[model samples]
Target: MNGGLIMKEVTNSDPFTIVGTEQYNMVSKMNREYRIFVSKPSEKPPASGYPVIYLLDGNSIFGTVVEAIRIQSKRPEKTGIVPAIVVGIGYPTEAPFSPHRFYDYTMAQTDQEMPFKPDGKPWPKQGGASEFLSFIEEELKPKIHQTLKVDSNKQTIFGHSLGGLFVLYTLFTSPRSFQSYIAGSPSLHWNERNILAKERSFMARLEREAIHAKLLIGIGELEKEHKSNIGELAKKMSERLSFYKNRGLNVKFIQFEDECHTSVLPPLINKSLRFSLHSQVDQ
Candidate 1:
């Protein structure tokens, strides 16, 4: 949050920009250069410092999240949204999303585990999720902490699609890394639904020690209708929600009406922000 961004003018020649947000490039230990975006609230930080939300697909949604936080957090009493730092991790690409996400957002899978592409094409190079998580925990986070005051106990991570799958992976394997998670339309069916196996281990860990973390899962109602291969995402996700609830995890599940995969992102991003930051506003 301490990264300084030169405020650029919003004009025909200059193009528009998010005023309070900063963007920088950092290379991971894996030698992957990522474009990092940070947006800090104008108000002073609370005694416990500001809650932080790390977002996947930074190039696509960084401004949306920044403006939502800027507008809604101004009146916490009415909005129930608190001032928080937003960090978006993405790639240095002119396009909205980089193709490299397939690797960064998915678990390692054997050739047999991966389903063939519908177009009869070979899959992109993938299965670098472990390294991606390492980059976040070991490299990116430490740099952010050094730059700003963040509430370690209130850290939240959010993702959608394959990124959502990574969110679940982080929760199951490294539950203590974040205090809350928001997974929107996760690709649970990936890798032959291997995430189900990870859930079992996560439950076992929870039974042995108390790890209080909040999870919110949201899926558009028409997801199944839009994508044939997904095969009843709402039903599958609901089952997972039940499993987490039975294990005594704090969780929330929502199915947005008439929304499909692409159309659901904006509302899901807004809902995720409120879900993660609302309760902490009064505290």
Candidate 2:
């Protein structure tokens, strides 16, 4: 099938048969409609609850994610990773899409011009991240939890570029949103604002009550001029880690030496998944 859509029929006697793919259309508080694709493992009975990975830019990465999860499910020994459900959040279009993602993902919006606004319209109208988090906490999470047998404690959020910015934002602003965060080539340069602000603030107010999480910040070593700027970014990220050194949070920063902004995600996803899983197991 196109887009790798696959379906399997199961008999009543077969409890371990693979369930076919399913699609969902959800409307946000803003009345914005989003298409979500969910894929589950081909296993049986106790409806084996699995981990959930919410992927941003789902339309672009959904197929890759599904394949990756399938491969892992089939060869856990080779991948050294556990099979999980991938929740792909898709946008309507690439441009108008920014506002939806920005509103949902950002903690706050400054007076920065959103990249790739074709109409140049005032963007990010609904940027109260708390509301978005509420949607996830009260709505999406509950829906997924009720519909699928998933480990509530094993939720992960994965994003790239601007989406990466949102992932980091959620990590600090809504610390309990997910158990693991994977940010690839985050637009650290967004709005000329430093994510460190949130990091530092969270550090000051951090409490043991916060959900423990694994934070993986990935960057393309070949991004931009490959000069002092990259070094500075890494240094600042390190400082954040230093601040939380004795805290319960687990943070890992990686620089792919040969990857560029556009090319870093594939490798980052693979490495970040393994790292996050390993860290989780260690804990």
Candidate 3:
């Protein structure tokens, strides 16, 4: 995690590359090459430097996120959104998504941990969440901190779907890793809700350590319409939201109307930016 991340400079030759953004490739300790995209605010940084947001599925959404930040943060006084650095963790592939993501975004599992599969098909090679997280904390963050003017205290992580699952996993397992978390349409039903098993430990840890962090979860209105093997995810999401709030966690849940799982991401992205970057984040 600490030593094996080797940064290699990449020239942005792609025609779709966003202006004012830089792309690079880094080899993780697992020897997996990841494409990293970064967009820095043009405005001068504050004394404590700008906040940072680490985005998953960067290849598909980096441009949207960068443009949103640039436009919204241009008039911070009016938008109530401050300038921030955006770090996109993607793969070294021309495709919008990489198959390798199935490994990076899931937790280590066993026969007992995941007793059944909804799809009834074998899952792709997975169980690398711990290593992937180490790549972020030990290899990636330090590199970013050393090279950029970012406020370590104001870090946030954003992910959607499986990546969203990773966001929640990070929060529950290592709450101090970031100040805020944005999970858009997370796959909570994965492996028969195995992720929920960790909730009790997370709550206990929060109480024992008196640690505080903010969470924002968003899902599309039509998510419940599509039936899964387990049940209606929209209801499940609501139930989990209530459970989190009841436990005295700083959390927010939003349901985007007139959208499905994929379509919800755009609005969710806009809201996520505000939720994470706004000065009054605790509210």
- Candidate 2 vs 3: which has more lDDT: 3
Candidate 3's C-alpha runs over 4 A off are 1-16, 112-121, 229-248
Best TM-score goes to which candidate? 1
| Candidate 1 lDDT for residue 13 | 69
lDDT of each: 0.83, 0.70, 0.82
Expressed as tens digits, the lDDT of each residue in 1-283 for candidate 3 is 4489877779676566566789999998879999999998888899999999999999999889999989999888888788899999999998989989889998766544443457786667778888999999999999999989999889999999888888988988888899988988887666334577666678666556665578888888788676652225534644654455544456777888988889998899899888889877634
RMSD to the true structure for each prediction, in A, is 6.9, 7.3, 9.8
Q: Considering TM-score, which of the candidate structures 2 and 3 is the better prediction for this target?
A: 3
Q: List the residue pairs that clash in candidate 1.
A: none
For model 1, how does the per-residue alpha-carbon lDDT over 96-130 read when each residue is reduced to its tens digit? 88989999988777535565789988778878889
Candidate with maximal lDDT: 1
Task: Give candidate 1 regions above 4 Å deviation.
Answer: 1-12, 111-119, 226-231, 241-248, 280-283
Q: After best superposition, candidate 3 residue 283: deviation in angstroms?
A: 6.2
lDDT of model 2 at position 46: 37
**TM-scores of the models, in the order given:** 0.89, 0.78, 0.86
